[model samples]
Each structure stands twice: as C-alpha cells, then as structure tokens.
Target: MSRSKFFLVVLICSFVWAFVPGYLFQSLTSISWVCWVFSKSVTAQQLGSGMKGLGLGAFTLDWTAVSSFLFSPLISPLFATVNVFVGYVLFIYVVMPTAYWGMNLYNAKTFPIFSSHLFASNGSPYKIADIVNQQFRLDTEAYDKLGRINLSIFFAISYGFNFATIAATITHVGFFYGKEIYHRFRASQQEEPDVHTKLMRKYEDIPAWWFYSVTALSMIVSLILCTVLKDQVQLPWWGFLFACAMAFTFTLPVSIISATTNQTPGLNVITEYVMGLIMPGYPIANVCFKVYGYISMSQAISFLADFKLGHYMKIPPKSMFIVQFVGTVVAGTVNLIVGWWLLGSVENICQDQLLPPNSPWTCPNDRVFFDASVIWGLVGPNRIFGSNGNYIALNWFFLFGAAGPVIVYILHRIFPTHKWILLINIPVLTGATALMPPATTVNFNSWLLYGIIFNFFVFRYRKKWWQRYNYILSAGLDAGAAFMGVLLYFTLTMENRTINWWGTGGEHCPLASCPTAKGVDLGPDSVCPVF
Candidate 1:
C-alpha cells in the first residue's frame, strides 16, 4: 500500500479504538464495578489483605518492560531496571516502613505508607480551596492557622529526590558522555551514517524546514491559545513563549542522553522549578507552564522517536507525521472525554473525606500535581528549601546529586580496572523513588520481585531462551492483559453486570488509600488508638 493509504488505515483504526470505549463508558457514570463488588454495609478494614493486592500489582508490570524496551532496545534497559529495583527495594521495604512504623516520622503510624493526599499539622486532610483567596492565591493567614502541610517522609524524600535526579542527570551526562556532548556542540561536524541512515538514503528525506515550519506554527497557535484561555490555564503569553523556548532548548540534550542510556530524564521537575522561580505565587499558571514546557517537549520527542523508527524502516516521513498527528488527536480526545466522565462520576476525587469507602480512584497523580503546584507554585522553592523552612535539609540533595556522579567519575579515573563506579547512577536511583504515591508498596514489591526473577534470574540462567522470547513474552502478556481488560469491560456492558469482589473494589487494601492520622474506628466496634 502507498504510505498515504497505510497512514489513513492506521489513523482510522486508532480513532475507532479510542472512540468506541470512550463513547460507551461516558454514559456509564454512576454504574461502576467497585460499587457492585463491595457491599455498602461492609466494615472498612485497616491496613489491607495481602494476596489480593499482589494480583493487581503484578498485572501492571507489562507496561514497564514495554516502555523500557521502547526507550532503547536489547540490554540497555537492564542496568536502569536493576538500579530501579534496588531503589524500590530500599525505599519500600527498608526506608518507608522504618520511617513510618519505627521512627513514627510525620506521625506516619496513624496514616498509610504511601499517599499523595496533603495533611495538616493536626493529622487532618488539608482542604486547598479553603486556604485559597478569591484571586486563587494562597491565603497566608488561613495556611498558618491550619498549619504547614504535613508530608510522609516517603513523599518528602520523593520530592527531594526529584531535585537530586535533575542535578544527577546533568553531572552524569557530563561525566559519562563528555566527549559525545562536545562533538554534538561542534560546528561543521559530519554526520556518521549508520546502517539505517545508509538504507534510508535511497528514500527522499524529509526537509528540516518542514519540521521547523510545523513547530513554529504550533508554537504560535499555543501562544494564541494560552492568551485566549489565560484565566482557564492561568499562563501568560510571555510564560507560554518562555516555556516553548525551554522545551526546544532541552529536547536535543535530553533525547541524546535517552538514546544512549535507555533512561529518559523528564523536564517536568526542571520546568516546574524554573516556573516557580520566574512566575511564583500563581499555582495554576505554574502547572500550566509545566504542561506546556514539559509535555510539549515530550510530545515532540515522541514524534521524533516515531520519525526515527520510520527512517530505520525506510518509511516515508510525511506518512509517519500524519499517523502520529491523527493518533495523538484521537488519543487526547478520548482521554479528555474519559477524564471528564470520571470527574463527573467519581465522587470526592482527591478529597479523602467525601470519597467512597475504600475507593481506589484517589487521584494520586492529581494529588501529587496539585501538591507540587502548592510547593513550587504557591509557596515557591525558597520556603521549602530555604533556611527557614521545615524541609531545608532537602536542599542539600541537589549538591548530593551533583557530587555523586563526579565522585563516581573520579573513582573510575583512580581505579581504571574497576567497573563498579560506572554502576552507581544517582538519577536512576532517585527516579525509582518517584511514583510512590500512585504506586503502592505492593506494586513496587511485585515489580521488583518480577524483575529479579525474570530479568536477573531467568535472563541470566536461560540466555538463549531469554534472547529469543524475552520481548515476545512481554508483548504476549501485555496483549493478553489488555485484551482481557477490554473484553471484561465490554462483557459487563453487554450483561449489565459488575464483578462483586473485595479484590476488584479496592477494599483488599483499605489502608492503602488512607492519608490522615485522625482516630477512626477500624470496624463496627474497634477504636484504633493513635500511635
């Protein structure tokens, strides 16, 4: 088939795939599988039932390997994955539990191990809206009365680690890829033709001007849109332009590192940090700036990745562009629709009090995002990392991150034969500590266990089988799980029935969602004491 025709077919399939479920599920507002599964009368349990959590946690592992492989093929992802597993094991198994249960830091014993919910000094959930003024700015008086927001040590560490990761990324790249970085910066550098580039030479290459034109046009559109929707997103036209510039500047450097290391460092934290510095005290604007700055670059890189793949396969560039454009539009539209539907359907969302008992839809990412806005946007980094703030110690993490890679580099230089210096990656370790709120202890544990068993044990002992079937097995598992999920959703729609089980309802790990240290009765007659 012609590239145009092939593009059309793929676009059509993508649209169909996105729209069908979205259209179907949009109207299934109040009717949820969880409501059917758990009885309203069932007493809310503390902590959780173990085995049930293991099942759900294990299923999500499919995307992990798939995503990692997509970043870089073959053994490139193994080192990063190993580092991640190590961090996961240390944080989830050792640090989190010890800090929460043993030291009782932040009064953690009364709350859950992992959460994104913001808490007050008195162990009550902080109502953000209550502390915001008419202008959407945080009211200092109200905030002070309610007290400084309390965070679990795990959550605090995750935030601190983000800064560490950013610092580490720059140092690590400088230390490891200094020569390559220098070459990339040099003028009149000749492009080395790889096998793919040589094969693609016969095909008409896409013009650089075409990409530049598209990007420039998109930036203009975004600028206009941001200006028009200033109140909605709160980003000024100048901020929008600045964000675009930041994205454009960082894209090449970040992509270069990702291409080599199989570990893609995100611009989210850096964007947020920059925005916080430039446009402090406007929470919405800060987040809006981040989305435009970070996600725009991410989206561009994603397209670039596809374009590279097309080049590798000797496919036409224009056709690849069309496919990506159509796919993005379809996916974004479907996602927005689903998000709207869920917002209307799901009660409370980030509000713990109003949420359904044992509700799984805690909006962990949203909570984190919102909290970040408060930290980096409303309060600004100065208070949190400055000498006066509660978390001033976290500021040192930036130095720690910078020093880590330099130390490793120095050690490697000193001991030329030792390879262990190359193995210690601060960025990977810090990145693994991220997503702790959205991902539970069980999730991390399961992922680590699976990685250890499969990547380490199986891949090590069974080399031939591993090389042949590793990705194939991953693809098969992902496909089967996705198919089953779709089938179940459709089946439920057809029969008008929902699965009735504690496992599906999230009652299996009731405490997993808990965020506060407030004394609440565990059961009908069980009053839990504050630790």
Candidate 2:
C-alpha cells in the first residue's frame, strides 16, 4: 500500500482501539493483572497497582496515557524519554518505595506509596477547610491548633525536584549555550544570520512599536483588573507587575530549552513560591499571580514558535503578527466556549467520590492544581516549607540542580571526544518525572515503550519508513482518539447511560492507599495494617 493508504488504515485502527480501552474494557486503562491475581492481599496490590501503588508489571492500553501531553513519545526524542524512564524507575520504584517501607521518611508509612493527596500524621485525609477562615484567608488560630500540613512522600519529594528543575534550566543553558549567546550579544563582530533569516529580508519587517503597543495596552488592562476589581481578583496591582517581571526574567532560558529539546520547565513552582511568601493567606491572589507568571511566558514561547514557522515559510512579518493576534483571540474564545459546555453538560464532573462507579469524569490534573493552591496559597509556605514545616531540607535541591551541570561540563572536558557525555542533559534528566502526581506509572510506562520502539529502533533501522510515517502516525492517532473521546462523552456519559461489570471500575487496589504504619487509623472504624 502507498504511505497515504497506510495512514488511513492506522487512523481507522486508532479509532477502533480507543473504544476497547476508553469504553468497552475500561480496566485496560489500569491493567494491574498482578493485583487481580492476589485479590485479597493488600500488600500484593500495594506492590502491583499501577494507579495507586508501585506499578510492578503494570501498564495501560490507552493511547491517551502515552501521548496526550507534552511527553508524547511521538515528539519527545528517545534519549529524553529514556532519561524520564530512568527517573521514574529510581524515584518511584526504588527511592519512594524504600522510604515508605524502610526508612519511613516524613511518616511515609502513614500514607499511600504514591498519591497527590495530602494527609495527616495518622494516615487520615487532611481537611483543608479547617485552616481557612470565612474570608478565605488562613485562620492562624485554626492552623496553630491543626499543626503543620503534611503531604504524601511522593508529593513532598516532587516539590523538591520542581525547585531543582527551575535551577537546572538556568545553569544548564549557561553551561551549554552561554558562550554562543554572549558572542551574539557583542556588537563588534557578528555571525551572519541563517538563510531563513536572510530570506525574510525581501518583505518589510514589523515595526518595533507594534509589539510595544500591544504590551502596553495589555499591562494597562491587567492593572485595571487588579486594582479596580480588587475584591474579586484579590491581586494587588504591584503583585501583577511583579508577576510580569518574573515571566520576563525566565522566558529567555525556559524558551531556549523548550525550542531545542521540547522540554519546558514550568514557572508555576517558583511563581507560587515567591508569591506565597510575598502575600500569604490569599489563595485567589496566589493563583492569579501564578497564572500571570507561568501562562504568560509559556504563551509567549508559543507565539515565538509561530513567528519562526512564518519566517521559515517565507511569510511577511507584518502578516504573521496580524494572523497570530487574531488567531489567538479566536482560539481562546473557542476554548472558553468548549470549557463551559463541558462543565455544564457533565454532572459531578470533577468530584470523583460523588461520581458513580466507572465514571471517567475524574479531574486528576485539576486535583493537583487545587492541592497546590492549598499548599502555597491558603496555608502558605510558612507552614509547608519554612521553619514551621516538616520538610525544610527540600530547599537543598536547588543547590543540587545548580551544581549538576558543572559536573557534566567537567566530564565533557575530561573526555572531549566522548559524544555520549554531552548527551547527559542534566536539565532534562532532573525534570524527567515532572508529570507525576497527575500522571500515573502506566502513563510513563506506555509512553516510554513507544518512544523506544519508534525513536530508537525504527529511527535507527528503518530510516526511510520512519521519516515518511512517524509524524503522520502521530497525527492520525491523536485525531482519531480525540474524536472518539468527545463522541463517547456526549453520546453515552452525558445522558447517564450506564454499564456495570467487574472490569469497568477503577484499579481494584483499595489497600494500595492504606498506610502500613502500625496503629495508624484511617477512620473511627478502620486502622492500618501492622505489617
């Protein structure tokens, strides 16, 4: 068959395959067969559950698990995928399990082996509202009585690495590309622009004032919202300005890594941390500041990518600017409409506990977002990462990340010809498991498995086939799966259509979340296993 024919065939197959895991046999999303084999053994399930536990011999059949987000195996290179796999194996399999079972760090034995959920010292859920007052600020008296908020071992360590990811981005970029950037900045002697840049000289370029006008108008509007609508927004105009400054500072380095390696370290962690310190007890303000600082930089990077595409395609700069501006407005409006439609159409949309069995409305990513608001905004860093906090040592990950690139640079110096030494991208390595919490073990496992198959095996052995079909394959599968998801949601799930079966519900590993610590009570009626 011709390549186009094969693409059509794969596209059809993708649509069909999505039904098996997405609807018919939902258990395929969490095929923890090991848990099924040892049905009654809590310990066994804890070791085998892909969604809630160690994920030994666990994998997902769902394509969304593998390709939905930025970590899509189709796009992220094999070497980068391997780095993520290494991070997952060591952290999830080795480090976290050992801490939970052996050292019992930070009451690790009192919480699930892997979860984003916050907990108390006694293995019970942390009631977030207990520490918040009527006006939604931190109630000091309530917090003092409640004591320090605690996170699962996974959540705690992940925050540490998050801090590291930011630090690593700066040092890694400087070590690898600092000299090149410095040379470019110097005005005396200059390297010629690339052919793409020179080719673009035919058309009149966009005036500098075009960009400045948009920026100034945006700042003015944002300032009005922050100050005039203070009651609803809760953010100070100064806080908004500071958030803009932070985005401006980090965009160059973050965008550099993103452009080259398809890796974009987030501004959320650092943004929220600084804002939490600056203005405590205001969750709305923190969330607002974070949205400004993180989203602005990422969106800016996206626009730059669009501009680069236009340049390479020989489109005029003025036309590119106009298209992007109008396109952005249209895209954003469409997104808002779709978001509202989904929110309104679905009942108990994100409330997992209240939803019926086998419901797929669980908003896992939103759960992570809410937990962040509680940790850094309502509770503030004073209770979570300062002297009053239990895990203050996590701040050291900053130093560790900053120092890592220095070591790699030294190793490259020692063996200049060893090309493999440079492949050790420290920034990518450290930020490998960045998707955990909202992402499961099966998600990483499935993504890595495909990354190896295509990027490593196919790219190396069948270069022609890969070059022709790889991206086409990605596009086909993504389009098919997305179409099926919307169709299923509207036709079946929204109308309260139901299905009942053993395999249709969640990963059957309830005990995986139960703390193994002796005498730790889950409720008035239940206590944790002694072993």
* Number of colliding residue pairs in each model: 0, 0
Please provide TM-scores, in order, for all candidate models, with all chains considered together. 0.79, 0.94
RMSD of 1: 7.1
lDDT tens string, model 2, 275-386?
A: 9998888999999999999999999998998888898889999999998889988998998998799799888887775787666778888888888988888888877898
Q: Give the per-residue lDDT digits (tens) of candidate 1, residues 60-86.
A: 222322232222123345676777767
Report every candidate's CA lDDT. 0.62, 0.83
Candidate achieving the largest lDDT:
2
- Candidate 1 weakest lDDT stretch, 10 residues: 45-54
lDDT of 2: 0.83
Clashes of 2: 0
Best by TM-score: 2
